[model samples]
Target: MLTKQDIVAVVVLYNPNKKVYDNILKYKGLVNRLILVDNSLTNNKYLFKNIDFVDYIPLYNNYGIAYALNLGIKNSTEKYILTMDQDSAISANLINSYLKFLNVNDNNGIGALTCQYNTDRNPAVAKKGYVKVRQSMQSGTLFKRSTFDKIGYFDDKLFIDVVDLEFFLRMKRSELSLVRINAAVLNHHPAETKVKKILFLKLKYGQSSEVRNYYKARNLFWVAKRYNSLDMYKGLTISWLKIILLYDDKRKYLKAFNQGIKDAKHNRLGKYYSNYEGN
Candidate 1:
């Protein structure tokens, strides 16, 4: 069993809401240290300046999750790092479980441990105590800090979406263990838009805005191109098509999709903004 001091919790903030602050309170005794990497454009950085048991680093811009996470990891001095989103909450015993699992798998080349979460596409492996999966989200994951040296940090070029998948694919290729616990600690669905079931076809996961759509499509395309996997290629085709067909304002969504494809083709990345014309 691992003690609290052995783990460090890092939360990436980008225009987070009130829940984030409330959750920060819960993290106080959960781990020995708490780090908040603020990427908000506004003056939200002031909120963390003198907080007890917290170290705040404000980027003052939307640098995306990957950058903030890398910053947090660099600042951490613990054996294990627990990465969390502003709105993420996990099982109370999550740390204990991770400690147990890692203790058992320390000599088995385990790089990280991910937890079960609510998702549109549920997998059967989640029903088991532990499942060796190729993909796991960044949030609700506990990582062995040394693994960063083995598998390079996240690609800053991808920016946001598919960032976790890219890292997962790389880990899978490296033969590193990426296991997901059956207990669903991090049950979060930030995207509250209702899923539109289309005439007996696949369900459309409603998106928040055009900006998000662009990142989603572009990053997926970029990953698919590099990985050259049939599932990714098929996902790339099907996902954007659903985004276009299911959105209320089809023209704006289609435009974002096209722009994403164009940017990916030209190797353009980092923060890109739209006029919010149709928003």
Candidate 2:
């Protein structure tokens, strides 16, 4: 149904490795243009300069995912935009399946479409057909360009964590649909995570650094407060507690959590201005 000419892919990179080039090759041919938004502290243009049909834009600083995505989206003129992470890759068939779904369904009402990600943290769930979801991760997701004109771009204040959730809330309020193609799969490499056996259950604990924990906690609280979703806020709070209890670095995480709560209550959003670094 949809051709390569109608799609543009944007891959956000942050200190990406050589393997990212191979990942780009997987879906580059499926789109008309591939925009690489590098959010690394240093330039990584040399890695993609030789590649064809790729527009590499390096922001010599860590501008965060929301800013990077907005930059890429603003430069593209394609009908559909595929937002991806450097560590994510999708098959050609998956692209065709998404286009086919768009052709058969009411494309106007669809705000965004995402595939079931096959990740190391949790394996993909095999299912037939598609289903509506509350929200989806930014990686391996296809968005309608017009959706932005209707609902506005992602909140730049969010920076990284929970940016997707904040955008989904706006989409929901606008009555735009977010769907997932169950059969289509995106192979994603997750961050460092380990399985820890706590009591009777083996929990997969995320090994995010202290800096990331701050952003996660702060953004989650702010987003929950902004949207007034009590259940969502409660669930995320409980999850964070479980991780702090079962994982190492309890004091650091607890401090970050408290700071995040204080910041959210004061409505202080944007980059963290603390001694800790790295996202």
Candidate 3:
């Protein structure tokens, strides 16, 4: 059984609303510490003094999710860190489930244990039970503090898209185990998507702005090239093909793809140029 002092929950915030606060409160009692990394453009410290366990760290600007997560990991004083996004939801038994899973598997070289998250993405996951994976999304993931020493922090250059995947790749190179528990489920709402059947294939894709398309293309190329992993490179290549081909706004996405390839060649990373018109 994991006690309150063993785990710290880090939830990153970006232009959050009252519902965000409400969601945070739901999980506060499950962990030892609750830390909020506020990346809002406005400088507003929202330390919940009433709840001594909660600590707020405001960046006053959008530093991206990777940066915020790295800051949380550094500030956490617990044995393990549980990461979540503002839009993530989890089963009520999330903490205890992870604790139970860790108790037996922690000694077996498990660096990060993430629960099965239902997403529209084409992630390679085992169909059942606890299965080892190369990468999983950040939400509902429990990572050991010591893994940072071996694998380093999340790649801040990634900014948003593929940050978790890049970090997990580093963990793999260091021989750290990345496992997912199929029973411990996480409900995540990723980019809105509708499944469409084209001939014999079922394609899952959604509308994405030029900004997102740019990041996805750039990061997929950058990380795949940097890691020299043919598996990821080939996988992302196919996924990108599907998104670009099946997307409703193919012209804009095609333009974004070209921009991304250009940016990746120039080594332009972090937050790219976006007019902040839409998500």
Estimate TM-scores for all models.
0.88, 0.93, 0.88
Candidate 1 per-residue lDDT, tens place, 1-279, comes to 568789999899988667777777777667889989888887675666566889988887888889989999999999888988888775556776777766665654788898877654443323547888877788989888877878988788887888888888888778788888775466556565566766787663646677777887788887888888665677678767776667678877788878888787777777764433354
Off by over 4 Å in 1: 119-128, 197-204, 274-279
Clashing residue pairs in all predictions, respectively, total: 0, 0, 0
Expressed as tens digits, the lDDT of each residue in 115-136 for candidate 3 is 8776656453324568898878
Ordered from best to worst lDDT, the candidate numbers read 2, 3, 1
- The all-Cα superposition gives candidate 2 an RMSD in Å to the true structure of 2.2
Indicate whether candidate 1 or candidate 3 has the larger lDDT. 3
Clashes of 3: 0
**Pairs of colliding residues, candidate 1:** none
lDDT of 2 by residue, 1-279 (tens): 677789899989999888887777776578899999999989888888878899999999888899999999999999998888888776786688788788888467889998898877778864779999987888878889999999999888988888888898899999999999987788777667788886899877557766677788888888888889774597567758755677677876777777777787887878874644422
Choose 2 or 3, whichever is better by TM-score: 2
Per-residue lDDT value at 174 in model 1: 80
Higher-scoring candidate on lDDT, 2 or 3? 2
Candidate 3 displacement at residue 192 in angstroms: 1.3
